[model samples]
Target chain A: MQINSSMKKSFLFKSLVDYLYILNVGGFLLLLTTISFGFVEINVIKGGDEHWSLLAISISCISVLTCIVFLRGVYYLRKMARHLLTHKYFSKQIIKCLKISGTHFLLAGVMFVVIMILGWIGKLREGLFEFVYDINLMVPLFLMIIGLFFMIQSEALLVAKNFKEENELTV
Target chain B: MPIIINLDVMLAKRKIRSKELSERIGITTSNLSILKSGKAKAIRFSTLEAICKALECQPKDILEYRDS
Candidate 1:
């Protein structure tokens, strides 16, 4: 059958969604490798007759959990893109995915802040605060802002979806 | 929702089958079914005109308003 304009649009979206899925998978693999290597380094430090502190274990656990949440957000983004490709742009599934991803981003921002505060305290205890610039703290703040933006975008999508539904039903 | 479509009643009174009426009105059988089943959110004036002409009826004969 001959392809129409809408089918062509869906095809383009499908390609973009595939690219995003590849990038998400690559990033997730890199993150896992980094976490594994970091754990090895921590183990080496503990092997030098020093016990692993409770704080250190807690930080590692929190880091892994936060990463998982962030990855889940990426997964939702991929799902949303796939839904768009399938011409389900104004669906409940898309809205739910957006909201879930937004919430994950917000949670990741909070986790980043907590981790940064812990790092800052550790630096202060070692008299390293003098060398730490305010610029170093900007990342978490930026993430928080981005998270808020995602949340707002999700809300906007929800409203647009509602309007589209109403329009469709009006016919 | 209170504006009920009496399309099926009119069709019955006119002794017309849905498929024949839909064909005469240049609409699909499914669209006619939607109108008959009261599932259509809104009907176009052109479609209403076509339906009225095909059924040889007035607008009020095919539509009724009742308080919910």
Candidate 2:
């Protein structure tokens, strides 16, 4: 069967979605690796054993949660895009993915404040290790909080609008 | 299977070029092609009206029903 131009445009959009998901996957992997590195280094710190354990535990938790979100998010997006190509252009699965990813962003925001307080304490003390979270972390955390909310609201709006209701006639 | 666009017949009778019709109708030639090929699922009333007005024709002049 011959394909139409509109189908071609739709495929292009799917490819874009695939590329974005690949980026998300790569970012998640990078985060995991970075956190593991920190975890290992923290375990090796002298006179900061307890603090290191706490930081390691928190970073590991964040990494695990982020990976779960990233994997599920990409899975849903890929499936949703394939379904859209065969049929129409909307998905509840995609909306769910957005919700999970948005929550991940919110966690990242909170992680920032925790790191900030620890970094300030480290700075005021002498002979502390070079593993302190920077005070400037709060600004970026605030930004991440804003970003997280944006994601949450945008997805919520899309799900609420439910373009399928507006576009496709019921069978 | 139900739509048969008579765009060619209307255009020929009116001596209008596809490019000119598209410009007047504010649609791309590619979209006009879709209409002409009867591949479009639907056309907006505004766009149908534009085509009729530009070609000095009626909706019946541009659209037909073909039993599948």
Candidate 3:
């Protein structure tokens, strides 16, 4: 009983679910504001003699979509943390949340890569290939790696859940 | 699947109620019910011994094997 109480208290004290939920909401509001500002700025710039290129518009669209997907991954992660706080470590809902979060991360990474490739091609067309470096490509690669890691972790959790069920049913 | 619990039969034969048997064996009625229903995946030797002792029966009398 003492151990159970301590465990409950520890989860309550250590869980970042609430904080992440707040951050997700705040980040979403910030993203919305930023996108709105970008649209206004784009219109203002278009009113002048300089018009936005198709590549620039495509890049903005991809960037916004990637940010949305990343935010969704954060939301799912928050859900997983909430489940952990409830002592549901091996639940199906938690596993599904993890899987969804990982998929979102992967999708965000793919979108980021597409944006980067478009940017690179745009630069190459302007004869600026020498400025393109591997350092600029690291962030999307990292996101992909992190996404794969989470997917593998979710599979491990599924196996652990199966074992826990078997143990419980063994009386 | 072949292993079966005959706890209910022994309890009936000995005229021992499940609640009384559970109290004497220091186990919950739900757990005893699980045993009786043959839904328990495994039983500890201590629990089996306690059950046998409370029911006044041998292990063989409380358990049976049937070719399923």
Query: What lDDT tens digits, residue by residue, belong to model 2 across residues A38-70?
Result: 853434223355555554555556546645644
Name the best candidate (by DockQ). 3
> Which portions of model 2 show Cα errors greater than 4 Å?
A1-87, A122-171, B1-68
The top-ranked prediction according to lDDT is: 3
Tens-place lDDT per residue, model 3, B1-68, is 79988988898899999999989988888888878888887888999888878877899998889998
Off by over 4 Å in 3: A1-31, A34-54, A130-136, B1-6, B23-26, B45-68
- Please compute the TM-score of chain B alone for each predicted structure, in the order given: 0.96, 0.94, 0.95
TM per model? 0.69, 0.38, 0.69
Q: Is candidate 1 or candidate 2 better by DockQ?
A: 1
Kindly report which residue pairs in candidate 2 clash with one another. Answer: none
**Model 3 global lDDT (CA atoms, 0 to 1):** 0.80
Pairwise DockQ winner, candidates 2 and 3: 3
lDDT per residue as tens, model 3, A119-164: 7787776777755567758888887887888898899999999887
Relative to the true structure, how large is the alpha-carbon lDDT of every model? Answer: 0.75, 0.65, 0.80
The superposed Cα distance between candidate 2 and the true structure at residue A8, in angstroms, equals: 7.4
DockQ (C-alpha based) per candidate is 0.40, 0.03, 0.42
User: In order, what fnat does every candidate score?
Assistant: 0.48, 0.00, 0.43
Instruction: In angstroms, give how far residue A82 of model 2 lies from its true place.
Output: 5.1
